[model samples]
Target: MLLELRDISVNYGKISAIRNISIGVPEGQIVTIIGGNGAGKTTTLRAMSGMLPLQGGEIYFDGKRVDGMAPHKIVAHGIAHVPEGRRIFPDMTVEENLRTGAFLRKDKDKIEADLEDVFNRFPRLRERRRQRAQTMSGGEQQMLAIGRALMSDPRVLLMDEPSMGLAPVIVEEIAVIIEEINQRGLSVVLVEQNAVLALELANYAYVLETGNMALEGPASELHDNEHVRAAYLGL
Candidate 1:
């Protein structure tokens, strides 16, 4: 596995957010976690990105332990997180926001190349390169957020609710970009409330319920399961 969480648990003060949550991301594949609100999907992504400290359990990525590492150090280890909201800098220009993603890297030339690549992938960003991120539409901002995460040249991407608050067309656009990113050899752990889209894009899926693993299987299998269809797909 490129990324593995072994029996992990997280807490907020004394309350448990997730308990014994275990999931794995194989190299170069898309793995998704799907559930309704408060299912611990975002919490799991935060833990994987080292933004939240784990109370119990371990995280391994690329053969090294990363549970207790600082968030910046986790980025240095080639895991980039596009957080739940499109958290681009409001006052910063689109280019500047993208540059921030590469703050840990010293390779100026490669950074430039990656910047151009991001621009190429997201031409709306290129068109609005000098515009402040706060001025863009929600879908555009989501694109910028994903583009910024890519600037880090990560081995894996942890994405939380990428489809949130977007039109269906925009959601499909983001989904295409995700598949393109995965095809380029970046592993992804996706947390999404849109179970239909999640299952469509992911190779494997894990269903979360009230901070626990409820079910898991290959995406195709889960898509056809009665419980999943009724609960999440609204069939």
Candidate 2:
């Protein structure tokens, strides 16, 4: 496994947000966690990126323990998180926001190359490179957020609800970008409430229910599951 969470738990003060959850992401594969709001999907992603401290269990990325590491340090170790909510710096230019993702790196030449690559992947961002991020539409901001994460050149990308608020067309575009990114060999751990899209994109799927692992299997299997169909697919 390239990324593994072993019986990990996260708490908010005295309340546990996630409990003994375990998931794995193999190299070059897209793995997804799907459930309703408050299912601990976002919390799990935060724990993996070191944004939330774990109360128990361990995290290993590329064979090195990373549970206690700082968030920036985790990014340096090749994990980039595109958090929930298009949290781009509103006042900054689109290009500036993208560059900030590489704050921990020192290779100027490679950073520039990565910036160009991001622009190419998101041509809308390139057209608005000099525009403030806040001025862009929701779909454009989502693209900028994803492009920014890719700027870090991470081996594993952790995304939280990349399709939260958008039209169907925009969601389809984001899905294409995600597939393209995975095809380029970056492993992904996606946390999404859109189970239909999640199951379609992921190679493997884990269903979370109020801080616990409810079910898991190959994506195709889950797609055909009765429970998943009733609860998530509206079928």
Candidate 3:
């Protein structure tokens, strides 16, 4: 595995958010965690990105233990997170926001090249490169958020709710972009409430309920699971 969360648990004050949750991401694969709201899906992603401290267990990226590393250091170690709610800087221009993703890097030439690649991947970002992110539509901000994460040149991208609050058309567009990103050799960890879309994009899937992992399997198998269909897919 390129990234592994071994029996990881996270807590909020005294309450456990997730317990003994283990997940693995092999190189160049898309792994998704799907669940209803408040299922600890976001918490699991936060733990992987080092945004939340673990209550127990370890996180290994490329074979190095990194559970206690600072969030920026995690980015430097090749994990970039596009957090829930498309957390772009509202006051910053698109270009500035993208540059922030590479804050830890001294490789100016490579950063510029990665910036160009992001702009090419999402041409709308290039069009609004100088525009404040707050002034853009919800979908555009989401694009900026994703492009900003890609600007970090990470080996793994952690995406949380990329389809939230968008029209079906834009959601589909984001899905295609995710596929393209994965095809280009970046592993992905997707946390989504949209089980159908997630299962379609991921090679493997884990289902979370409350603070525990309920089920897991190959994406195709989970999609056809009776319980998953009844609860998540409304089948």
Candidate 4:
């Protein structure tokens, strides 16, 4: 497995956000977590990225325990998180924001090459390479945030609510980009409230409800589940 969460638990003061939740992602596959509000989907991704410390359980990445590592160290270990809210540097130019993602790397030539590759994958980013990210639309900002994460040349990408607050058309575009990224051999763990799209894109899926894992299976199996259809797909 590329990533594994074993009986992980997270706390917010005295309240538990997640408990005994276990999930695993193999290399070069798209895994998704789907649920409604307050489901702890984002919390799970944060825990794996070391942004939130696990009070119990363990997280292993490439066979190394990584539960309590610092966020920067996690990135150094080849994980990049495109956090919710598209938290790009608002005042920085697109190029500058992308450079920030590569702060730990000292190889300038490789960084430059990766930057060009990101621009190629996201031509709109190249066009706005000099523009401040704050001036861009929500969809564009999301793309920039994703591009910045890619600049780090990560092995596993953690994406939280990538389609949030976008028009349907923009959401579809993000989905296509995710598929394209996976095709290039990067592993992904996507957390979203959009169950339909999540299941459609992912090979494996986990369903969370109020901090507990409710179901786990292949995406195709879950999509055909009566309860999943009724609750998540509204079918």
For model 4, how does the per-residue alpha-carbon lDDT over 18-85 read when each residue is reduced to its tens digit?
A: 98999999999999999999999999999999999888999999999988899989999899999999
Per-residue CA lDDT of model 2 for 158-184, tens digit only, reads 999999999999999999999999999
Better of 2 and 3 by lDDT: 2
Q: What is candidate 1's CA lDDT for residue 196?
A: 90
Q: For candidate 4, give the lDDT of residue 73.
A: 92
Question: Whole-model lDDT for model 4 versus the true structure?
Answer: 0.94
**Per-residue C-alpha lDDT of model 1 across residues 1-235, encoded as one tens digit per residue:** 9999999999999999999999999999999999999989999999998889999999999889999999989999999999989799999999999999999899999999999999999999999999999999999999999999999999999999999999999999999999999999999999999999999999999999999999999999999999999999999
Deviating ranges (above 4 Å) for candidate 1: none
lDDT: which is higher, 1 or 4?
1
Tell me the tens digit of each residue's lDDT in model 3 across 156-175: 99999999999999999999
Structural similarity to truth (TM-score) of each candidate:
0.99, 0.98, 0.98, 0.98
Model 4: lDDT of residue 188: 95
Candidate 2 similarity to native, TM-score: 0.98
lDDT of 2 at 171: 97
